[model samples]
Target: MIDNRDPLSRLKAALQVIDSQRKILSDSKSDEMLVRDLSAIVRYLNSMSISQASHILEKAHRRGHDQKKNQAEDFTQAYNLNLDDIQSIIDSENVTRGELESIAVGRFQVPKGSLRSIGNMEQLKMKVSTLVQNERSHQTISKLAGDHKYK
Candidate 1:
């Protein structure tokens, strides 16, 4: 139960618990502890005012999103699809510009007009190959940065 008499104080107390748990998990480098602490934080935040929780939550979400996007881009690069070949395939398949994104990601939910724009199975396979290359490149970069202090 939140103490309405001193809501700010209650929030601060919850924040203190979260901060301490985070410190402990970080220092010990324990994934299990980190997960537990993160769950606890989420639970605590659920009762808090949106204005109070938005700042930290947004920052965390943005960082995670950027990391995922970078990983995807790296995968695309590793697929080794030359620009010319990729463009040619897209042109030859009459791929819709909007649906092109879906096809690139192996998600083909093409609508009526876009249905005829899909390339042959072979061409789709080539696009898949390219996507994998980008993913692999991203993984390599992530590994290097995390494990080797590489730029």
Candidate 2:
């Protein structure tokens, strides 16, 4: 139960009123009703004290930020993905890297510029090919040396 005199209670009641007005506007069949409902909501908001309005806005902003952080943390914990890994997947899939990076930094809270140095898919493929060739050469030399020693 909330006391009617409490700031939080008043804010909650105001939000509920606004929400009801929105519902009425959505269901309204006439332009006049729509305009009236919208004007009422606007007037109610305008009449609210500056301090109360600011407090509500601040709480809403903080709540949204906390939700994003929590969601990002949960995703990382479940999928074991870091920014580099995500970038690699995005590159491999041939998707837009910039958009994905923006989402990663803005919504997922990944540190900005973390994947700036990650090479493209083509570069990664070339590096893998070079490593494979070097490994093959090393194995061939080792096999030849062993054969000669056994002769």
Candidate 3:
């Protein structure tokens, strides 16, 4: 005899089985691991509901779109730069506005001059310092010699 029972009773029986499985898995796992896994499962189950899942996905998509828009907005534009602004920085600092403008405008190429004068300038500075020291030494020697001659 095929007897038709309540459909809700069948759902309840399935739920009980799932609950037992969840408890068994939780019991086997460490407390921390159990909490993490259970939390993930709960989140996934909640998302399975059509409205909740759509809402989460919609929020995520909106966030991603906004992030890309913000990134695009952050990009530097050539039109935003001013020649006076570059010149002001140069006047206030050791760097020149022309050099800054050249750097800013990729098309404006500057030739790298030879550093040959750098070594020469460094040698000249060292020579000047040495000459000054030598002059002082000579003065001291001359004074000592004069004092000995007088004694």
The numbered model that scores best in TM-score is: 2
Clashes of each: 11, 0, 0
lDDT (tens digit, per residue) of candidate 3 on 1-151: 2122433343344445665666777778757676567657654554355455455556766999997675334323322434445334334536533333333332122222322232443343343334345656787899999889943
Instruction: Kindly list the per-residue Cα lDDT of model 2 for residues 1-65, writing each as its tens digit.
Output: 65554665666676777767776766775477675777787667767885877687678779999
Residue 93, model 2: lDDT of 56
Q: After superposition, how far is residue 37 of candidate 2 from its true place, in Å?
A: 0.6
lDDT of 3: 0.47
Off by over 4 Å in 3: 1-44, 77-79, 82-151
Q: Compared with the true structure, what per-residue lDDT tens digits does model 1 show for residues 87-138?
A: 5556565544433444454332224354346566555555544654675688
Instruction: Give each prediction's root-mean-square deviation over alpha carbons.
Output: 19.7, 13.3, 24.4
As a whole number from 0 to 100, the lDDT of residue 26 in candidate 3 is 73
TM-scores vs. true structure, each candidate = 0.25, 0.35, 0.29
RMSD, model 1, all Cα superposed? Answer: 19.7
| Rank ordering of all candidates by TM-score, starting from the highest | 2, 3, 1
What do the candidate models score in CA lDDT, each in turn? 0.59, 0.60, 0.47
**What is the lDDT, from 0 to 100, of the residue 63 in candidate 3?**
100
Model 1 ranges with Cα > 4 A deviation: 1-49, 81-151
Q: Pick the candidate with the highest lDDT.
A: 2
